[model samples]
Target chain A: MYKHTTDGLRTLLNIPDNYQIFFLSSATEIWERIIQNCVEHTSFHCVNGSFSKRFYEFSGELGKKAFKEEAAFGKGFYPEKFEIPAETEAICLTQNETSSGVSMPVADINKIREKNKEALLFVDAVSSLPYPEFDFTKIDSTFFSVQKCFGLPAGLGVWILNDRVIEKAKQLEAKKVLTGTYHTISSILSKAKDNQTPETPNVWNIFLLGKVIEDMNKKGIATIRKETEVKADMLYNYIKDSNNFSFGVEDPAHRSKTTIVANTAIPAPEVNKKLEQFDLAVGSGYSSYKEKQIRIANFPAYSVEKTEELVNALKKTIG
Target chain B: MYKHTTDGLRTLLNIPDNYQIFFLSSATEIWERIIQNCVEHTSFHCVNGSFSKRFYEFSGELGKKAFKEEAAFGKGFYPEKFEIPAETEAICLTQNETSSGVSMPVADINKIREKNKEALLFVDAVSSLPYPEFDFTKIDSTFFSVQKCFGLPAGLGVWILNDRVIEKAKQLEAKKVLTGTYHTISSILSKAKDNQTPETPNVWNIFLLGKVIEDMNKKGIATIRKETEVKADMLYNYIKDSNNFSFGVEDPAHRSKTTIVANTAIPAPEVNKKLEQFDLAVGSGYSSYKEKQIRIANFPAYSVEKTEELVNALKKTIG
Candidate 1:
């Protein structure tokens, strides 16, 4: 099941043959574990939104020399403007920022490889996957929690890393640095060789993931991506033309295809209540914006017709 | 659901009102986190078997001064012989050695308090709880995984700690020591105040744990404990009187009431195969003894009548 799921996801995301996949408890835990295994001293992050910013804080908390080039919330980072320190060991990028619905283009991720040829490039594809058409060869690692795109319950996170990431961990372990207590890169790699985890994993979720990905495989990744794109467009176009609502990310290219954030003129809770009356549920703005913005998840599972119903419901309530 | 489960377990286990319960990913992960959050310098482990030795190794992995007083496999630690260093920040104990089926009596745990007044007492009740009637006042912390006694799918771990454990973490944090990155005692406490976990947790498993514990509550803990004792005695007596089998632990007092291990003249796999033929399954011995011994789990979920069937099958097959 583990291998089948990895193979299916690799084929779905265009991941190369050499990249290794590891299962973790959650994406939040991966923030610290990635720093422990992959980073030696400095970690440079491209923080455009809340989720990316939280990852940045995790590096600092772990006593790493952490630096970040920030963009405004709901804005994506431009690769050309990123002035990462040459001494940085890892360059962290959130491919899609779920909190604010901003996403980096595949081109920007590839450009990072050209700029920082030495540093390991890690991407957080938490909200946007199977939709991003990511060229995994250009990135050292990419990870996501299954709940977002795979439409599974929370608890399992998928971490992908290249051989280079493993080698770096080997170097650090040889240097007698505290890479981690358990779930170190070496332990993870050794366990994966046996199709096992160092600890008792979320076996149920892993099984479900394999089955879901196989089902997705039969349906094909291209079809899911195309449908996701159409649904995202429908939602974005509706927000664009509405007087009472506006797209969170002003630049359309930077908008996430999975999580679509909309700034509402009315209180977000009132909007949520109105939508609930129609039995259409959308997420409230995260953190402080809980009453200020409406966040809608437009994943592969949310069909085009259902998204259209949401748009229609919003049109009636907001207008 | 978490609160309901915790409440049920506390009532069943005789846990006090002030002790806090926090959920983690696995019992294995708890080994490292316990050292990180509670231990500042030295940790002394009463290593009678594999699991306790693994916890000792975890302390060493995190650059701590780790010391262990060893006992032979399937033997319990004698507190009178323990010469623990006064500077030890924590004393680790495995209440039940899952690998060897040996349990540290609650009396010995109280004796440790007499010797080490300063060090926090940490107990790994992974395979023993809500069966072990632990006195929470004597121990600073204890943890268990739901897959053991609760008979749930593996994923969630429950860490029970007292106020002193929190104070120790705060002291370490104030001293600028590396307590942890995320899921630190401070972080877990802060989030748990809001009745939430620090990250996205195993929601489904937690729900299952709550439901299972409620069912156990309806049946009552006293009746469960009495049944477990009777089943354990039945199995032990069967091994002792049999020509082909004998108890793994030499001292009857040290034997685990939950996991019962028996050395068999026949290969462990053969024993397992014979049991499988009866439409019953038993675990082979762990690791090195995999071919030499049989391990049987006598958890709360295993009914007395079912246990009797297993004993009867063993009687006919071994003879």
Candidate 2:
């Protein structure tokens, strides 16, 4: 089952030969583990929204000296202007901040590696993975949950790491630093060699994820990503023209392709209530934006026709 | 789903109001969490099999001073003669060693409490939880995975801890010691009060577990325990009189009622292959005993009549 999932995921995501995938409980846990295993003293973060801020906070909570180049909610970081400290061991980035519908362009993510050549590059591709064609060799590590782009039930996290991460972890072990017990990098890698996990994993999810990836392969990755962009453009174009709703992220370049967030004149619950009549529901805003915003997930499951139906309903409610 | 699972679990196990239930990935993870949260300096363990030994190793891996009283693979601990050092912060016990099929009698577990009143008592009821009716008030903490007795898919762990655990964790925090981050005792307890978790948990498994527990509740715990014992006695009695098989655990008093292990004259795979003809399968042994023994599970899903069929098949294989 492990081999099936790993092979299927590798093929689906176009994971490069240099990178290896390890499974964990969630991307939330991968945050904790990155801080535990990768960083020795200081780490840098690009914090723009709730999800990005959490990785920074986890670094601090894990007793690391965590630094961040901060941006307001719904804003994106300019990697050129940001300076990671010389002591930074790892730099964290959120490819798509689920909280505010902000995405750091893949070009921007690639630039961080060039600037901070000594630091390990870790990206939270949580809400966007298979949709984004990343040059896996450029990034030291990246992770995501199955519940997002894969359209599977939540429980499993796929962590993709390269050789540098392993070297740093082995060095830390030699220094007698406490990494973790069951899900340590070395332990997970050892089991991976045998097509197993250190503990009994979410077996059902693994099997389901494998099946989902196989189907995705049949449909083709290029087709899926292209359809996603088409649907996203439809939703954004409608929101652009609507009077009652506006783009959540002001910059068009920073707007997320997968998670489309918008400011609503009416409360989010009211918007959700109207959508519920069509048997269509989008998530309410997260954290402080609870009442002010609505989050529409532009997943593969949301077809173009279904998205068109959503847009027409939007016009009827508050054109 | 959190409310449903916790409420259902509390009723099914008759958990005291003073105790709280928090979920994790697996009982294997609960071992690491206990070492991180409960023990500051040292822990004592009864080492008889792979599962219990893994807990002890986790303590040492986390850099704690771990001491243990050793027993052979198939033997039970003699709590009266074993002395846990006064400085020991936690005492670990495996109620049923699935690897060896030796159950430390609940009375023996209760005696550890009488003698080591100061240390926290932690039991790994991994393979034999809801089946054993323990006086929850007498033990400080116990944990189990739903895959075992609940007969559900793997990935959810139930950690039942009393208030005393919180006090110890608070003390450790005050001293600036590192407990965990996301699933820390304080964080989990806070979310649990709201019927929530710190992160997006295994929602599907939690829902399935709640449904399973609800069904188990309707059937009643006493009746399930009685049926398990009846099935166990049937298997054990047959093994006692058979020429091809014998009890895995030498001490009759220590044999498990949930996991029935038998030393087979024929290889376990051959026995399993014979059983497979009848659409039946039993687990081969753990670790070194993998080829020499067969482990049969007496779960609630297996009725007395079904167990009788298994027994008849066993006789046909080697009568």
lDDT of 1 by residue, B141-249 (tens): 9999989988988888899999999999999999988877668999998888877898899998988988998898888889988999999998898898988888899
State candidate 2's DockQ: 0.77
lDDT of 1 by residue, A1-319 (tens): 7787888877777778788889999998888889988777899998877889889998888888999998988888778876899999999999999889998999989988888899999999988876787776788888999899899989999998899998999998999989887699999889998888999899889989898888888889999989999998899999998988888898878988899998988988888788988898888897877777889998888888999999999889886
Least well predicted 10-residue stretch by lDDT in candidate 2 chain A? A129-138
Off by over 4 Å in 1: none
- Candidate 2: global Cα-lDDT? 0.89
Enumerate residue pairs that collide in model 1. none
Alpha carbon deviation, residue B312, candidate 1 (Å) = 0.9
What is the lDDT of every predicted structure here? Answer: 0.88, 0.89
Give the C-alpha miss distance for residue B169 in model 2, angstroms: 1.0
| CAPRI class of candidate 2 | medium
- The lowest-lDDT stretch of 10 consecutive residues in candidate 2 chain B is B172-181
lDDT of 2 by residue, B1-319 (tens): 8888889989988999999999898899899989999889999999999999999999998989999998998889887778889999999999999899999899888988988899999989999988888988679999999898888888888899999988898888788788878878988888989988887778889999999999999999999999999999999999999999999999888999999999999999999889888999888988889999989988888899999999999898876
